[model samples]
Target: MTSRVNPQQPSGTAPVVPAHRVVVLLFEGLQLMDVTGPLDVYTAANEYGAHYVTSTVSPDGGPVTTTAGLRLVPDLSLDEVDFPVDTLVIPGRPDWWAAVADTALVAGITRLADRARTVASVCAGAFPLAATGLLDGRRAATHWRLADDLAARYPKVEVDSDAIFVRDGRFITSAGISAGIDLTLSLVESDLGPDIARKAAKFLVVFMARPGGQSQFSVRQSPRHPAHSVLRQVLDQVAADPAADHGLPALAARAGVSSRHLTRLFRTETGGTAAQYVERIRVEAAQALLEAGDDALDTVARRSGFGSEETLRRAFRRRLGVSPGIYRDRFRTTRPHGTRED
Candidate 1:
C-alpha cells in the first residue's frame, strides 16, 4: 500500500497532506479523560489514512501515574525527542497548579514550546502554558473555576472562562476534559478543512460542529428555591425578548414584587445584579442566532439585542477572543442542500 503525504506534520504549513507528527505530553496525576479524549480522536484520524503520528512524553522517561491510578508510559523523555512536531498537546492533571510549581515540568513544557508548530493544553494544563509565559497578553481560555486564578497569576494574559477552547496564534487552551475533544477535532478541521473534521466528529459520535460563543457560567444563574420559580419564569421571558429594553422596574412588575426587593433577591440567589444577568442572557441569545447561519450578521445582531454588528463583534472579541464572523464560520451549521462548506 502506498502511504499518503501528511500535511499537518510540518509546522505552519497549509495542510494538503495528512498529519505527520503529533505529540501528547503526560505527567504525574494527569486526568484520564483529558489524555484519552484527544488521543482517541487523533487515533481515528490516523485510521482514516490521515497519516498521523502520536507519542507520549514525560520529563523523566518513565511511567506517570494519573489521578485515577492509570499509569501511562512515555515514548520519549523530555531530553530525547528530536522529531519536528506539528501539534504538541498537554493533558490536564488533577493538581496541575501544584505540579506547575515544579521546575522540571515547567522546563519540559518550555522546551516543547520552542519546537512545536502549535502548542496546546487541556484544562489545568494551561497552568504550565501560562507559567511558560507563552500566553502573556494573548487570548486564552481554561476551566471556568481556574479563570480568576489564571488571570491573577498571569496578570499579563487575558482569560475568557466561557470558551470551550481558545486559539491565540499557535497557542491553544481548552476548558475541562470533554472540550479537549472539541478542540482536537477543530485542530484537525483547521489543518485539513471542515470535511475531515466533520467526518472525525461523526466517527467519534461527538458534536464537533456547534455554533455560538462560549457561554459563561457567570451568566447562568441557579435558582435558590423551588418557590423561586417565579424568578425563573421572568428569566425565561427576558431570554425570549432580549432586544426589548426591559429594566428592573418592568421585571419586578412582571414578577409581582417591588423592584428593590427583586434586585436583592436576584443578587442573593444568582450572585449577580439583574442587569448583569440580562446582559448574559442577551449575549447568549445573540450567539445562537449567529451560529444558526440563517440570518445576516446585522440581522442576527439586532435580534439578539446587540443593536448592531459592530457591537456584537466587540463583545465577541472581548469575551470569545475571536471575531463573530470567524466564530460563525467555525461553528455555524450549513444547510445540507443549499449551503456551501467553504
Candidate 2:
C-alpha cells in the first residue's frame, strides 16, 4: 500500500509522505546561510500544499556546529537514513575543506548522491561534489574565488565563475553565499512553477528574479581618475567591443606594452589577469545580448564572441545549464529593454 501526505502538515506528523524529499547534508562547520536559504524557500511553499519535505543529515546523527557556532542536531545519520530523496543539498563550509578531505564525509556525500534523483551544492560545497566525481564532464559553477581551482582540479568539469548557478541535468551548483537563495528560488520555480518562485522571492524581498545570465557580481571596475587616461581609454574600448577577439598580445599591442607586462599590470590593478578580466567583459556583453536582443542564435553567438551557434550553445549549457532558447523563453519579455536583469 502507498501513503499520501498533506503538504500543510510538517514532516513526521503523518504517515510516510510521497512528497518530494529534500535532504540537506550537514557536515561539520556547514555554512548556516546555505542551509537556511533553501530551507526557508521550501518552508514558504509548504503552506500551499506544495511541500518539499526537508531534513538535515550527517554521517552520524550527532550534534554538529555551524560556522557561526550554532549547534544543529540532524534527524538522521548516513548509516541510519533511508528516505526517498528527490534532491540532496550540500551546503558550503569553507573552513571544513581540509577536514572534509581528511574525513569520510565527502565519501558519504558521494554515496548519498548516487541514491538521490538530483544533487545540489551551494558555494564551497562544490568542492565536495567535485571530489565525489559526480561533476566530471558536467558544467558546474562555484564561488568565483574557487572557480579556477575547481576547474583546474577537475579538468573534465567546465566551471563558470560568472554564473549565479549552473544546473547540469541533475547536478546544480551556485556561487557564494546569497547565490544559494537564487539557486533555491530556481529550484522552487522548477518544482512548483514560476508563480510560486516569484512569490517566494517577493516574500524574501529579493529584488527581481535573478536570471542565470546575470553575473554573480558585475565587473564594473572603472578608472579612479582621468589621470589614468590610457588604461581608461582601453577599458572603454574593450567594453564597447567585447566581441573583438582581443587577447593579451593584441591588447598589449594596443596599449603599447609587452604581453607579459600587461598581464602583470592587469593582475595588479584589477585583481585578475588580462585574460580573466577580458573574459569578464565578454561575459557581460553576452548578458546584454541575452537580455536585450531577439537576434537569431547565430547572430547572438557572433556578437558575444562565442564564434558560432554551436559554440554559444556549449558555453551556455556549461554556464547556465540550459540552452539559449530555454533561457530566453523563461526570462525574456516582449517589451523593449524588458529583460530579467532589468
Please tell me which predicted candidate would have the highest TM-score against the true structure: 1
State in Å the error of residue 123, model 2.
0.5
How would you encode candidate 2's per-residue C-alpha lDDT over 12-71 as one tens digit per residue? Answer: 665332477888888788889988888877776554455567878888878889889998
Provide TM-scores for the models: 0.73, 0.67
Candidate 2 lDDT at 35 equals 88
True-structure Cα RMSD, model 2: 7.3
* lDDT tens per residue, model 1, 1-342: 112334335665554454467878888888988888888777766545475678788898899899889888888888887878888998877676786798889888998989999998999889888898889989888888788888988999899877878888999888888888888887887777676666666677776454214653435443344257767777778877898866899888988999998888777777777877776777778767766656777887788777888887777777666666666655543423214321
Candidate 1, RMSD to the unseen true structure: 5.8
What is the overall TM-score of model 2 with all chains considered together?
Answer: 0.67
lDDT for position 299 in model 2:
87
Model 1 per-residue lDDT at 92? 79
